[model samples]
Target: MRSDTLDERSAVKLLLWLLLFVLCWPLALLALLLWPVVWLLSLPFRLIGISVEAVFALLRAVLFLPARLLGHKDA
Candidate 1:
């Protein structure tokens, strides 16, 4: 079900890009060409974001450990 939503979103994005291509081929071509370089440049930032998220999760779990031990349920 989630995959279907993602596919639909991809389809919509593609359609929007096609419309851009039809309106201004040069800009669309430039975007298509630069997208890979942009994604590659952003990869490290994405990794950092994931690492930060994991750290926050660990902190949350550690903080909640005493409550959990006392038979408190997570809300």
Candidate 2:
């Protein structure tokens, strides 16, 4: 009110609202408006993550079997 310009005050107010919308509003509407699109886009990433996990699990099992057979480890 003293010296700040109207544009500056309006910009500050807009920034506050923008922050709130980005932080809280999205959480509430998650999977509501863009469920199908987001899920579709993420399908590849999800599959890759799952495949990597599966490969790691298989390797762990293979390594454990050999070590156990040689009496080098308990598990």
Candidate 3:
């Protein structure tokens, strides 16, 4: 016997995807910002475009630097 509504399954899938996205988001942001994407994207920041995802992007910049520097220059 199986029991699960389509809506309930969709909700569970959404939650799983959100968790996966969050776990993988730093890597995504790192790729975006380390490349030309941030410059292209951030241009709007000074003007009239800001978003929650942008906030996450900013946080990724801070988090990535220290580990990156340490890797480059060993203490």
Candidate 4:
């Protein structure tokens, strides 16, 4: 079966979390509470990464512009 779909992935995640809850409810609760805080803390770093990626893409396009103008096609 195709288990790569979003619904299947979510089901798998829920099952794993349920197992964790059954084994150690306290740790599961801690993870649930801290997940949002950790994501928030990393937001700035994510934005910086996106900005750097954009800059690199722009640089690559600039570097390739002359080749594109000279009728060079991507191989």
Candidate 5:
């Protein structure tokens, strides 16, 4: 009885592992194939995000210029 339980558990584990591999392989392959394309497509959005970040940074610098010139260094 003990041996049978152990064998069953191992078989179930193997089956689950196999199922996971089979299910995931196609997705992995698809991602691998499309990663560059997806990245290319998202380049514009990434550029926009960077531009917005830069704009905000410049705005902050301009807004704080007076305080900085007055020697009010933020601790």
Candidate 6:
């Protein structure tokens, strides 16, 4: 389930990047060139986002423990 969500997210990002690239190749090329630097600059925020996601996932699992133990399948 988590893998599916990750795959979907990656696909969406790729599609959007492709759309931008098609619309303006020069700008896209510049973005491609700058991606590594931008990503490095944003690394801290990305880490925070991942941490928050993990916390929420853990909270959800705790909240759903009873239903899971009773064999109530998630829809």
Per-residue alpha-carbon lDDT of model 4 for 1-75, expressed as tens digits? 565797888999999999999999999999999999999999999999999999999999999999999999998
Q: What does candidate 3's lDDT look like per residue over 1-75, in tens digits?
A: 235687788899778666756889876556545668667777877665457678889998788889888785435
Q: What lDDT is obtained when candidate 5 is compared to the true structure?
A: 0.87
RMSD per candidate (Å) reads 1.1, 14.4, 18.1, 2.8, 13.4, 6.0
Each candidate structure's TM-score, on Cα atoms with residue i matched to residue i, is 0.93, 0.48, 0.29, 0.88, 0.66, 0.53
Candidate 2's C-alpha runs over 4 A off are 1-31, 70-75
The best-first sequence of candidates by TM-score reads 1, 4, 5, 6, 2, 3
Best by lDDT: 1
lDDT (10s digit) by residue, model 5, range 1-75: 599999999999778666755889776667667879999999999999999999999999999999999999897
Q: Backbone clashes in each candidate structure, one number apiece?
A: 0, 0, 0, 0, 0, 0
Candidate 6 clashing pairs?
none
User: Judged by TM-score relative to the true structure, which candidate is superior, 5 or 6?
Assistant: 5
Go through the candidates in order and give each one's C-alpha lDDT.
0.98, 0.80, 0.72, 0.96, 0.87, 0.95
Q: lDDT score, residue 16, model 3? A: 68
Query: Which runs of model 6 end up more than 4 angstroms from their true locations?
Result: 1-35
In model 3, pairs of residues that clash are none
Per-residue alpha-carbon lDDT of model 6 for 1-75, expressed as tens digits? 699999999999999889999999899889889999998999999999999999999999999999999999989
lDDT of 3 at 36: 88
The TM-score obtained by model 4 is 0.88
Pairs that collide in candidate 1 are: none
| Per-residue lDDT of 47 in model 2 | 97
